[model samples]
Target: MSHAPTHVTCSAVSFDWPDGTPVFDGFHWAVGPGRTGLIGLNGCGKSTLLKLVAGELSPGEGQISVAGTLGYLPQNVTLDTGARVDEVLGIRTTRAALHAIEAGEATEANFAAVGDDWDVEERALATLDQLGLARIGLDRTVGELSGGECVLLRLAALLLARPDVLLLDEPTNNLDLRARHRLYAAVESWNGVMVLVSHDRELLERVDQIADLRDGEVRWYGGNFTDYEAMLAAEQEAAERMVRVAEGDVERQKRELAEAHLKLARRKRYGQKMFENKREPKIVMGARKRAAQESAGKHRIMHTEKLAEARERLDQAVEAVRDDAEIRIELPATQVHPGRRVLTLTDLHLAHGARVEGEWEVRGPERIALVGGNGSGKTTLLRTIAGLLPPASGEAVTHVPTRFLPQRLDVLDDGRTVAENVARFAPHASNNVIRARLAHFLFRGARADRAAGTLSGGERFRAALAALLLAEPAPQLLMLDEPTNNLDLASARQLTGALESYEGALLVASHDVPFLESIGITRWLLLDGTLRPTTAQEVRESRWDG
Candidate 1:
């Protein structure tokens, strides 16, 4: 059936963080019924914008309007540990009223509370099942659920609300492969106005359009992320051509200005000779000199203005080109020989009772992809290898120096500056050397001195990465637990690029298929009770517990 047009509009909206950091200034955008992927660099205020639309935060200026009821799923989904699934799904009150009426206690309040939602419990169960949470049931408490399950539960809650305008921010951050697939299905089936901010490439590919938030403004692209990328590539090529042409124009202007000066000097010389030789009357000579001087003055001003204008055009052309920086560093010390055994696990039993069961070995600079559902002991295994967690039964031995980058990126001392953090890790490195290296990671000059706690998500990640890579003795074995969890697309790419230079044995636990593939994962190990060897194709086709 046809329905009223659903849309969301923001007019002249302006917002800033409490610390006076500007986010949006006089920004305006509108989205009609269909899913629009809001893609941008990290710290571009994607989450903040969603919060503003959801009414969790107010704009400093302007207004926001949504055509119908709105539902929002934030990046970090937190639930009370004691709360039940039904309560989180917002059906607890209605469910209780329905049960009261079913029990023959037909009170007016119960009926009113259950108005038009008599089947809420059933609907909630169905939604949960759709999100692969059927086993969770309605009675389970949040404390019993895994991180991935919690993310899915929050999404299920939003779906149950069925609001006309839906806003989701990084909904797939901690989700497993199966949960991500479920979210993708939900997005595909959504018919209302939906806006999501996510770096998950697979999820972004499902959108109807892409709205790129950059420089405090929104730029619209007519199709999905693939289309957006193609279009951006073409635009960048054109921008580069413009820059070249502008550079040529500026050079030509410089030569012309020089020629103008040469002509002015010759004119003065000629005029002086004429006046000295008395070739004309005194008044005529004087008038001639004055005319020549004025002409030179005008000529100088004209050329100067033209040069300034040309330079401005060059600046504009350069600005049109995207300048996203890439991370580049050398780690020659991390190299491992083909026969070297980097890590070994022998009947390792973790704290939560998940066991490695048998002996496993990682040799050379092998890149291993650790894949499984959340709470599958991937983090525990990595931690054990790093010596942060002791194995309950067996042992996790590292033949080389190892470093573990946790999901939260807590490696950095928050109170310390980024430079100080890096120095802490690389105590022997000189300050100049650390700063020079930090520049390659996009923390140039004064930025390296900023406190780690004050850094944005992307910045903090870079800092933590820098510290890890710059550590003393060099990390010959690096373990990253869901490294791409909270990173934006650019930052994720940066991490991938940095890994390209890494010559160490790598073990990364992640649900990002594309990222694993990009980094050339040499082995795929499914971490259930045992570490089962699997292929990328099998991993893609397989489903795991919620």
Candidate 2:
């Protein structure tokens, strides 16, 4: 069977901020069949580019041409709160609206004829059920379901659309271990072109190509995040060597220029005090003047050449990514004196219509990692610790001041401006102090005054963390639930670098194996119905999912 070919062509595409500051400068890339992962560190414009592909936002200049339909899953969905899961799937109401239009419901006669619209609801419900969203509460309010559930609900709708090209932005954020695995499985079987952005290295390894974004440019490779990192390192090494050679040339020129100036000055001083025509001295003076002029001219030419060499060297030095490391916040000091027994859980149980289960006790600077497949209880464990969910039995104990940064940072107020949110949580802080604190997180000036709703994914995340740090005495115990979800590699490294030197104890639940390992986790706890220490064998085999 011969099938037609289609493509998404973006030529010389560019976008700008409201103030006309360029976000993308003549950026261009294309998409085709199989899995294509869009890689970038925070603020590199991945989300904005994705918006262009989704047709939610237009470009400032250049043309973007798509030959077929598009399907997208945004990083976050704005739910009506009162809407049911099936109703949110698009199909439920789509049918009634189409039927009404077909019957000319705009005309008073057909409006009465199209009574009780139940026909499409059944089919929508069936489509959702087929994707394992059977018990997703077709009637439950959107506000009642968990973050993971909302993401899954949105996934169902996108799947039903079946567009020629699919754009998924951080689909694994806020998801537990088991939930992440399920997402990968679904993507692996997808029959259309996919362009995704995720920090989950394990997830990216499954894609066909990895396109990394850094310092406002995109570079693509044939493998996963790890593979891309290796290539990046090699390229940087070569660039550095070139810079070193350029520096040598620059220095040589500077020295020659200085010598020329000195010679020219000496000759001028001698000539200025010339006592020519003093018998034999007149002939000697003439010879000296002639030689000095030649020497001075040669030096002058060398100096000019040196200046040009320096400029070339500076240009070569600009390729280094070292300056892009953002996040300058003075993270709350980690060094704390927590009580001997920080936390102890004596046989806690989470009832899913069964007997007692889930039991464990964690205490003292135990850098523990909770790992499991998607749908496993990683985030649930984090939540239970956060006190959002109650244990069915037993008890959870903690003796230190704790703070939890959820996968979605839902702790922040979406409707509030960055400053307002900071002021609300850190009311004791003076206006000047609060602004300075937010500035360190890169919210800077007018951007900090903008409502949280208007910020990009990276900006929202930075604001959320800034709010947490504003408390007078920072929390001594830190809990992070998939903190790397929507963060690009550069942002993730900036965050991880800060956390490594932090003085507080940390309990992390993440699928970024490389990052987790870098932080030097002291132990691993795999979540089943209960929490238990992982075996050495399991640790050896743990890798970014492929």
Candidate 3:
């Protein structure tokens, strides 16, 4: 039985950029009331499509119907840096309410005009509580909140509108482990349609369907990331086989053309001999000459045409469909022999403002994780280990050379070429040596010639790593701070795989659960002004528990 139609339905969507470069060409998608991830590489038409659905941009052609209410959380915009968290949450509705209250005109009709429902303090508190923000003071403002907190508040405020559909752009960009989990939980429990666009694999995997936007087409797969990968692999294999067959056909056609030309040459020479010998009457000889000439001309034309066709086929066979994945990166060898016990922090003390005593410590050769939300000092502890920040008072001994990848991506030289950046970080190496190293990081050919700032987020990572690989004596201790930020799924997996092969010790401060699991992280040291060791399972189950 056919039921009522959905709120979102687009027919024959097509759009082009300012210069007439096609962005999305004749794409169609019907979004029902459920979570569907709008997956694509960065700069794919996901954002453009989102604008079309939100009615921000008119489609170049076709009809787009979006019924019911819509809630949207954009990727980035100007925010009140000096305002507190509470004010940002309540600013729009709160100001209207305040004006109503101050005027002593708190009429029911007035409240209805401001928002869909009456503007009540109790109702605001209820909504806040539902979104995990009950106790927060409205007067506190947005300035006090960090990136993750601000994102959470923005999401909470949108959810309060109780929209029929929610559109989130990069929802997990600035979130940490706890807050990411919080968002995942909220989305999983949601009843309305959710269209989420994010680069996070773990986040994308949770959605119902994934769309791969490439070359102005929406190649959507009807499942999660795994299913997409499986289908892609099968298709790539099929394409590979087709290319091989095409190559063989091209070669066979070339051989046949060559044989035909050889036969034509023989026929022409035989005709010439008959003409010279004068073996028949002139008229009969003329007819024979005409026939030979015609036959020779046709063979030459056919052979040349066949050769041209074979060349075209060869070109097609070489450039046929193929998956272009940029993931092959090599990790540098450890030069500094990890001295027995490369690093040791026993009965350590760390503090946010006040010290949490004698509860934290780690040893060498251990692949440990330091996980917590923003302002929780995961970065602080990583810095402490890297010797960037010294301890207040603790027995911290580090015998190995350590390299730290900061969250800010400062290890790379933004002004220089990718190869130059690598050389700068690794000053001891020659130019050729440095370029080779950069090439191994997948910034090969013209890509390595590009400036560091000009590269994509994933390419920037390779440049940073190229420099880090030059750590003197080869650091046996590698500490990465949020290494998974902005990384595509394939790149993240490749980086994780490379790290897994390293014999050196690793301490990573990351919210990417899938990456941590893939690289074999054992116990985690939960960061909350202090460090506490716990199992991976425990970290996943609890929320905001110190």
Q: Residue by residue across 291-406, what tens digits does model 2's lDDT show?
A: 87887777687679667968676676755634554666665454555445666666666543111244454556667776654455677667777788886777667667777888
Which candidate comes out best when scored by lDDT?
A: 1
Best by TM-score: 1
As for TM-score, the candidate ahead, 1 or 3, is 1
TM-score of 1: 0.93
Off by more than 4 A, model 1 = 1-6, 413-416, 427-432, 543-546
Model 3: per-residue lDDT, tens digit, 1-546?
023444677788888755465666777777887788886654456767777888888888888887677878876533687766545565455556657766998877556556644454556566556555565655566666666777777887676667787888778866876667677777877777788877776777788877676766667777877887898888778777877877787788778878887887887788778878988888988898898789878877887787777777667656656444544444446523434566667655544432346534345467888777676777767777777777676755667778889866788777788877776666788878776766656666777777776565666776776677555566677889888775666567657765755667788887777678888886677776556666777666656442
lDDT of each: 0.90, 0.72, 0.70
Residue 237 shift from truth in candidate 3, angstroms: 4.1
Instruction: Kindly list the per-residue Cα lDDT of model 1 for residues 445-468, writing each as its tens digit.
Output: 988988887676778888998999
Who is ahead in lDDT, 1 or 3? 1
Task: Give the backbone clash total of model 3.
Answer: 9
- How far does residue 178 in candidate 1 sit from its true spot (Å)? 2.0
List the candidates ranked by lDDT, beginning with the highest. 1, 2, 3
